[model samples]
Target chain A: MNGTLEISGLSKSYREPVLDHLDLTIDDGVFALLGPNGAGKTTLVSILTTLVLPDSGYARIGGVDVVTSPREARRLFAATGQETTLDDLLTGRENLVMLGRLLGLGRGATRRADALLEQFDLAPAGRRTVATYSGGMRRRLDLAASLLTQPAVLFLDEPTTGLDPVSRNRVWDDIRALAETGTTVFLTTQTLDEAEALADRIAVLRAGRLVADGTAEELIAAVGGQRLVLLDSERNEVRSIDTDGTAASLAHAMSSLHAHEQGLHVALRSPSLDDAFIALTQTHQEVAA
Target chain B: MTALAPDRPSSAHGVGPWRSSGVFIGRSLRHSLRDGEGMLMAVALPVILLLLFTYVFGGAIIADGYVDFVVPGVILTCAGYGAASVAVSVNRDITLGAMRRFRTLPIVSATVLAGHVVASVLRNLVATMIVILVALAIGFRPSATVLEWFGALGLVAMWILAITALFACIGLVSGSVEAANGYGFILLFLPYLSSAFVPIETMPAWLQPIATHQPMGPLVEAIRALLTGAGEAPALVSLAWSCGIIALSMVLITLALPRSKDR
Candidate 1:
């Protein structure tokens, strides 16, 4: 129940640094590492999951070092990688059963397999080979296989990367449900809304470093309140001005002719994770440079 | 976190010591069985080669007793070739994300390689039996006693196990399933180069020494001797080669398994 993931001063590089001395600690709940492509989200998950080693520092799952004591750390979590690990030749149920047995489930493997199949709404397809299943079904079954042993933590690396919207929501519900049982869920994603919706705490990673870490509200607040924008015909912003959502600020802002232009598109926008990400990382990169 | 000790089984649910191997081996065997085309090819390739050699090339190359002489080579070659397919299977698993999940699990991941090797050996045994039965139908005969028959079977199984392990290592290090297939094909041709098909003496003079020196030559020669009662068993040398290959493959597998996802 005390499941927590902690990584400190962790770094890894192939040609260039993929993860640069990154540090973060996450308690039991839904924690998301949000980043764009090539921001080292997968690399960090690999290191934390013990699939890849770091050049230096340490990563731990439930206080067990993933690098120094990977086998021990492995006990605390099951990872559903970007690629679904389900065997295409095997049935969905068989895939779960195999993992169950491998995790030492014995005869109980079948029971667990059935339970997971039903839980993931895969019982109907459980007998069908994975090769015959839809992409979403395979992703769901992949999640089911990971939960066969019911480890304390679950690591989802881009779990819904190629999923349909409906499937993505189903997986999101599953992650949420697992965390409700006091199981820690560590996830990585590029979708801002996914992190804002699912993660109790979110860490924004940019070029292998933590640019921002906070709740969704905190991140949005950090970016600023709201924006008034004058856009060109292409919807590209021509002039942007920040303003409080209050009518007084809007009235005062509209009073300026410098902000008004003929045939200009006018739009009021609320700050989102995208704005925060850009603002946070833009400043961090500038400072670093 | 770095100071923690190895935890009690996340899998205290494991029934016994053999559970890991049992589960993985079953998984592997089931995979082999389900691949109907692959399974068919495993059995048919050897038999087809046997027929082609015994009828087409056997009479032209030898002045009689050709069927008897070629049967041993075909049986061993079929099994070796079948076992070498482990490289393709193993590489598929690696490329398909099976290994990525395995590494993150609580089980001894090395059992994955064991599973492939064991399954290949078992599957090859079945294919070898069918090949021999076909040989008998085609006037091929072996003069071995019951003890020698068992010895021949065991030798073939050992050779399969060793090559399967070696190919499994090849699978682990290979970047792609196609690449693994290409590498395994290199070893597959060894049977043709060595005495597995024709006697080494029939080869060009310069090529004879190379054929005689390769492991397949000693191994096939040993099995041929046991099957035909043609000469003394030089099986100790074949056994040594099998053990060495298995040992070296095991070490390479361990080294490669952990680093598979790194690249």
Candidate 2:
């Protein structure tokens, strides 16, 4: 529970409901809160990060209530915001060391700053001011600053919203590497691909509430099972079949295609989360109606 | 890959409250020094005005000892100019991601504003001295005792602290850095219209009352008295105004700071 988050009946509203009595729990691992533009993804992160207070409900980070004791909860985590929260005028090393000093690290602050700069492969660029840094460098430096004081939980608010594919992959690798070390990462994303690519557990939020919560495969199954398209040597579709997406069912479906043609190729396509999101969102609306 | 590891906060083993304040103050000081243009303008504006008024406009005015009289006023204006940037810096911290990140940490976020104010005050004091030295070289002389000179310096410092805090409040409430800078410009113009350049009596009758009532007027009059060894210092009156501005700005900042962090 040291890196876990629990929320129950958490609600917040500005002009209207942004996050309605939403309840959620995240265990130790990479968890993604996937939602479109206004699904209260930020509101949730803001509340958890103590940027804003929720109207009603409680949220606990690693079992410490964020509302009642934000300072204690602060000690348990670090966050990287969407807007690149860095002092552009300061050198990367200065920024990191300043954060270390602010966090009360004393001389260790400088030592950690140097070590982090080298580790991020930014030792060469650490002497440069952030204003001169490229977008990728800025993000990497921002991440380095956040990790100055390692927290049990790490919150990344849309960690890669506007990065090129290569930079995005680098950040992804860094994130995945962090999760491998047993730090619970809670990230929010508008793109389902990012969620699926990074999160072990994905929760889709719609209009201030959660519509579905499960693994990628479970949400994929919710919309429809996997599709099997048998192709000939020319790569033209020879036969199409639907299966329940289970190991046995996929085996059966593949075997059925095996008897049809000797030179056929079999291609299996997993269900997309885009379809799963639409299906789940429509299901919630239908039930409400 | 484990670069950020074993990196947990050493809060328990490190600095006390005073050292924490030192780091924030040091950051703002660095920013003040790096902003070369602002610092230059703060020193240059007063020096430029002193020369212009002492030579350019001095022949037209019949007032005796104009340089001596105008130097104190110019120093007061110089402090105002130096304090102006505090608002812009404060606004940047609030509207940008810097203060947002700070709030998430274990430190009190209000210290950012305090750092700005203290750093601005120190920067302005230095600018004030440069202006004074420039005035002295250009035939400006005063007849104050050593203690009175100290009194004038202390009063000027208090006035700088007050104005700096006021600008900081402007920055806190401003929606953008440009807006804060604009407000600073408005503050810069206020000292010019006061008894800074010419005596309030020389102004049109209607404008005289407005100039006399402004915050800069009392401090200028008091400082002039202290330096010239002339009549009443009106030190109590200027102190009251400076204290009032400091108190009001502090109240507004205390009230505005928490809400500044909100959406």
Candidate 3:
């Protein structure tokens, strides 16, 4: 597939099955895995990043088997987990330099660290210990440390969960820049707007299984038509026509109906990505019921 | 874009994995040095204990001479304190997610543990020197030769390793930093209650037997033999006890280490 990630029959469970025979592939772009809380997204990331082992599934990164050659596979990837793993005792610069050294960079590790600090806009606060850093700064430093090796595949688990909108946008810009450099980005997030804004491809996971996977536009199209409404009698009381629940169809229905009423108020109810997501998942829930 | 470009250098002096391990070790040592409270405790506690014993309790306690009686005991006690520090530091690191971060890194798993252990040894050596200087200042003198002094230092270093390993294992099993601290204090306290502080003969008859056979007694007596040219047999007994503790603790720590899933 010429992809960075390939997983098959990836099953992992602690007492009960968390991921049930899950399969997924991520190619050379930013892919967002969207799921509700406790949908095993973190577990999947853990297994994929070699932080946790799956019971029966095999995973490969850049065509290297993660199980037998984890050291080799680890060289090609970096993961920023949901948990804050940065050592509080170390300065932000020290943390980056340590990671660089661990990744086999020698005397030039400090130079790389300085560059990363500057890139992340953390050069001013880089000398202060991480304990004194704000949550957003620590998050940025954690992201910077993970990039010390410049891994081909980067996994960010809920990177912007606690970030303000401005900080989140800044991180998103960094992620985009990384992807533009041919680095494959794998991220899981609960923010629909984030996924909509950044994801080249999106996969919806419910209860550890892939319910839907496609481009955002394709997924939106698959959810069906929109509703169109027109008020014929009064401003408050409106009579509707062609309420199919698709944006394009609703726009056509509204325009066609708008011509017929002289004093009528018309509106188009186009289905949004949020609406499509809720409708699709709710339908799946109903079928399961 | 050019700045972000990978700066692949020539392979003439390519750094290997072992060199990376050395860097990790150096990083850990730097962390220890910067830990203000830890550095204070590692340097100050042993010297305080030595001064308190020699000045406050030196006159009453006698087995040929006070320096002869107290030096061995203080060295062993300092080794015990060193062990406590190792346990506390290791436990704190684990609880703070430092060990977990190290596990996820591309470096060898054993490197982090090795770095901390070596740092602990070096810290203890410094503490030992301070204690010796303080003892000399207080009119205590060693009867042993220069070679014997070095031999004594070497034995105490080995003793620190054994004791530190045991406490490090305890720290691993401990659920929290507080628990590890408490456990380490208790481990160090055991040596004080044994013959390390006072003569076993001076204790109650029932307690005397337990005090003589305890780990600290043999280790302290061995240091005493080396420092004062008392005898070689006691040193052999001390070496045996130290080896036993080291072997047992290593096995326990190996088993106690968390698996990838647990982390």
Interface RMSD of 1: 7.5
Model 1 residue runs over 4 Å out of place are: A231-267, B1-17, B259-263
lDDT of 3 by residue, A1-289 (tens): 1337999999888877788899888877999998888888998888877778888878898897777776667777878878777877789999888777777777877988898899899998999889899778888888887777667788889998888888888888888877776668898998788888889999887777888888888777777565466666655686656456656765666566536556776566656788767876777778768
Candidates ranked, most accurate by TM-score first:
1, 2, 3
DockQ of each: 0.42, 0.34, 0.27
- What is the Cα-based TM-score of model 2? 0.90
Instruction: Provide TM-scores for the models.
Output: 0.91, 0.90, 0.87
> Candidate 1 has which clashing residue pairs, if any?
A104-B13, A104-B14
Q: Write the per-residue lDDT of candidate 1 for residues A104-145, one digit (tens) a residue.
A: 776777887887787888888999999999888988898877
Candidate 2 regions exceeding 4 Å error are A226-269, A282-289, B1-17, B259-262
Residue-level lDDT tens digits of model 1 in B200-263: 8889999998898788878788888999976667798889989999999988888887552465
Q: How far out, in Å, is residue B76 in model 3? A: 2.2
- Model 1 residue B139 lDDT score: 93
Which numbered prediction scores highest in lDDT against the true structure?
Answer: 2
